[model samples]
Target: MKRPGIMIKDVFKRLTMKPVTSKYPAEKSPAEPGYRGKMEFYVDKCISCGMCAKDCPSFACVMEEIDGKKRPVFYLDKCMFCAQCEESCPKDAIKMTTEYELAHLAGNPQIVK
Candidate 1:
């Protein structure tokens, strides 16, 4: 246990330094190349192969019959954003976007069609 005076130098140094954190929500920072964020599903490009649902480790991608065709219903709440669905899509229907602001009120699952 050192004296209280010992920490004074460190305190002063830190106070003089600029804040490392950015002002988020006001000043948005660009995501790096290949940075996976949100999942975007292209309905037209999808072949209803169910590969994305099969590859998803979190079970976020669930296939349902829509308009007599099997389509993926994404539950963003359960998604880990691993991008496995995007990789498994043979038709290139699923893509990962740079939009990371996915927060919502409780009971809102943030489901994607």
Candidate 2:
């Protein structure tokens, strides 16, 4: 059994405040410097070498045989958002970009070859 006057005062003050949330989509946000978004592979620069796969800390990177050639297959789901893949990359084939926003309602992130 609490006082009704106290409850009414708290509710009235909440309605007077300005909205604190940002309008997403309508108001886009930029990624911070060095932020890692989606990972893109440079096929031409890639020598089909297994160096990146062997050195990946999270094991998110893998190589698959395709028409007698080994190509990289990366699963973003397992990726730890660390820049290890980019640093261990000798050929500079794997580069990191600032892509922080990657939310989806339906499917997870996919990189098509």
Candidate maximizing lDDT: 1
How well is each residue in 47-112 modelled by candidate 2, as lDDT tens digits?
886887898888888898867779787877777777787787789988787776656665756552
For residues 38-82, what per-residue lDDT tens digits would candidate 1 score against the true structure? Answer: 888889998898998999999999999999989999999999999
- Model 2 spans > 4 angstroms off: 1-21, 105-109
Which one wins on TM-score? 1
Error of 2 at 17 (Å): 12
Q: Rate the local accuracy (lDDT) of all candidates.
A: 0.90, 0.76
* C-alpha RMSD between model 1 and the true structure: 3.3
